[model samples]
Target: MPAQIYALDISGRRTRPADPLSGHRQESWRVNLLNNNDVLLTQLVGVVGGEFTFNVNAAIRGSGSIEYSGTPLDWNQHRVQPIYRTEAGGAAVEWPLGVFLVATPSSEYKDGDRTVSLEMYDKTKILEDDLIPASYQVAKGSNVITAVRAVLALSGQTRTAFEESTQTLATAMVWPAGTSRLRIINDLLESVNYFSIWVDGDGVFRTSPYLSPADRGMSWEFEDNEKSIYSPEFTHDFDTFDVPNRVIVTGQSDGDTAAPVAVAEDNGTGPFSIATRGRVISRYEEGQEASSQATLQAIAERLLQTGQQVGSTFSIQHAPIPIDLNSVVAFRRGVEAIDVATTLQTISYSMDTGALCSTTLREFIQ
Candidate 1:
């Protein structure tokens, strides 16, 4: 036969503000399931204007009954008013529940909209044999805990792989600036058929097009009528120029002079520095895949001398710059990852001004 369990009752109350002149006031009361000792498991606070919500989680155990009630203090006393109730089964079990309450003030209550309050109750059953007082249980003879750890490890690996794949795709397409131009170039590279042509900054025209049957499958053409301009600009400006007062040097020989080294004079802050303002510019005709390829190759070679590749993926990011006394230094940093294989293309740039800008070029491959 299944074991029988008793219901637990819960209850609480809060006083309402009294009228200033009449001196009449009332208290609000609420009730819920209580355990064998009549200790209330749920309590309700004073409600205002008819709406309330709270974050709560609850769990109940055993075949126990639960009940809730509410009463107003100005009127006759009520023993128990049921606001919420639930029944438990004979077997040991956990029941999770949340409660919300809404109430309209009586006509005699003065000067307010409807009243509302939210209450939370958690119920759990304790078993006689399994109950341990003031202590947590340690698992002795089961692999459940270890199995959970293994599952977490597998999930972590999957999450890591997903993040890596996302980052790889993100770095594959370079978008230094001009996202709008990148979109246009990506579309042209993907959709255009015929010959691919590009106009360079110096006005050079180049093309790679599918030739008619008379000329065979494909041909490349270059126009020498106009010179293309390459004007990639890199500029840096310094905001401060105070020179350091002290210079520290190591490895002074015993016979060397012991006088301190002279402080170096400060150079006037300018817009360009050999170190800060170095940039490369290349011009290619509308459809010159070879020019694009060569340009990317050159840039990659230059970047290789400065930064290491971030993995199998092609992305170059700068290392953290060390601070120098009284001045900030800017360096040229770039990466070239996408290989141009087709003629139909678009060029993009990152710079805010100038005709030839930085952009992410998307080339669609069949």
Candidate 2:
């Protein structure tokens, strides 16, 4: 694989090179940087040491981050992205490994080479730095999509990618002064079905709904066969300690009225069901932004409906591929019962040519 790294000015402004061979241009969605509406910088000249690894976790805030090592270059700016040509000179297909914030980097001096260890985080960290000022109030009956866009704009974000949300608020949403802007956004999204909001490969804020493994289809499959993608290692783990059959969700109460409450119980008649378990293993959560009992009940049901199959994870090592987060992948061991299915929760890999990648997948409830 042929790979190239691009940079942006410290102020996040630059022009995309008109020449394709200039090392500054890659086939990707043209994104205007957060600081300015310009393209990327000239390519860095050096040998990159570890994998060009990126991370996406099942989280509401700070869901993405990246780390890698390379020979020292003039890198004082705060932004970067990597593009790799899949088959060096074989095809034109390239992968843009997402833009990132480059603030904390360490260096090492070997026998002859000077390598810098660069660990950069996603743009969510930037949003976490800005606190919402006083008088930031969202009115009742406001659509959640509009509210999320408005809050991002207040933080000086102009580029965003959002899933549709036509659900309206039942009561006005208000937050006290001096709260993290990203926190407010997280709260607002839960009013709809979205639970994980993070930046994508092109450096744009994006949101998507959380679904059980049962609701998604497998994106890739692993088998210990010669025709497969060379999965060299495999590991499986099952975690049932925290699995809950009942979930109780409640909304905040006002000065005079009690909060709306809703209960979601395990209705499945499986081995882990309330019937089989012989007791109600319940989980409780609060602060749902709703006013009607129906809305609260829907949120509670969504929370309980996920991970009901005793959430587990299986890991594998294979050739690096650009699989999106929250993707469902399955593995087939020879034994019938050893076969497993799950969702891609965390992934990281290096930039070294032909370097194998190790990733972990969380089992989706069947």
Candidate 3:
């Protein structure tokens, strides 16, 4: 017996049609249609090309052909109409017809590794012709000493030390004296912890604390066409002097008088007090031989102490003055025996200079 086949119409309904023209068609051909899900087995049948029609409930829908009995079978179905010539005709029948069957080639699949490389580039440079100004203006009629004190207060330095340094610098320089005062003022400003001293007509004297060159709000650049200028040559002397007795006084006096009187008396005191007094006195003298050495040393020591308590409170080291009390004593005795009298003078310090001194804190007690 020929193998059974099944197919669906464009509407996807399944129906098995009868051969009305073939004598082989029985009055009631109970042809068994392939099971709905088992239709794929028809491919193994000998059917090569023919059309087959079948009917299924409205729920079954699809399109495709099957082969059976060496013939291609195409199947399709139409909705039953109410008006029918015969009641039997009204009954749906799945019809089978011969058709051409062709298998579609399958798609090819390929898999391998894919690699991609990415590159990035960037460039940066400054192109502006004019940059912001590097200059600062000193307020008119500003007292350098007051400014220094203010800065010192801001930096948390001792008011007494700041005031003392301010007074010393003020007395050392003539107020508003050209650019000398300004230069000194600029040199001393770093913060509230560091102060500067320069030798004026009177020996070593403090300036109103000003910002250090590095800390100054101002920056300098050579003119577009100007050449670099080097610093002037300076001589370094290492002569050592012995001091027998040294005295330091705080009161103001002429540093140029033929016989300058000691501002305070110094009885033989403890070594530390005597040495400190001697240092203070030696710092105040006639001629431009003033020494910031002592002040710097004291500031450095203070900085070290501050660092011990906190850490790296300031950027620059405080002044480092190495004082040998023995040397100081010998030097003082020589001066006393020779009756060498140096006058002390007082002058006003510039506002800018004073500001610098106020900011730097003393890092050491010495």
Model 2 C-alpha RMSD to native:
7.4
Residue-wise C-alpha lDDT for candidate 3, range 22-113, written one tens digit per residue: 11211211112332221323223332222211111111111123222322233221111000011122233232211112233122223742
RMSD of each: 31.5, 7.4, 46.1
lDDT of every predicted structure (CA atoms): 0.21, 0.63, 0.24
lDDT of 1 by residue, 1-366 (tens): 011122333331222321111112121223333333333454433322121111111111111112212334321111111232122221111111112111222332326433322222111111112222232221222222232223223222111111011001101122233223312222222121222222211112122322322233112111111221222232222221221211221211224543222111112232222233333122221321111232323323322211111111111121111111111111222331223212211122111112222211111111
- Identify the runs in model 2 with alpha carbons over 4 angstroms from their true place: 1-38, 52-78, 88-92, 110-113, 133-135, 230-232, 254-257, 291-294, 307-310
State the lDDT at 205 in candidate 1.
19
Q: What TM-scores do the predictions have? A: 0.13, 0.79, 0.17
Relative to the true structure, candidate 3 reaches a TM of 0.17
Q: Which candidate number would show the highest lDDT if scored against the true structure?
A: 2
* Residues 255-305 of candidate 2: C-alpha lDDT, one tens digit per residue: 568888899887778655789788888889877786357667877878776
| Positional deviation of residue 106's Cα in model 1 after best superposition, in angstroms | 15
Which of 2 and 3 is ahead in TM-score?
Answer: 2
Task: Please give the lDDT score at residue 213 for candidate 2.
Answer: 57
Error of 2 at 171 (Å): 2.1
Clashing pairs in 2: 51-350, 51-351, 52-350, 52-351
Question: What lDDT would candidate 1 get against the real structure?
Answer: 0.21
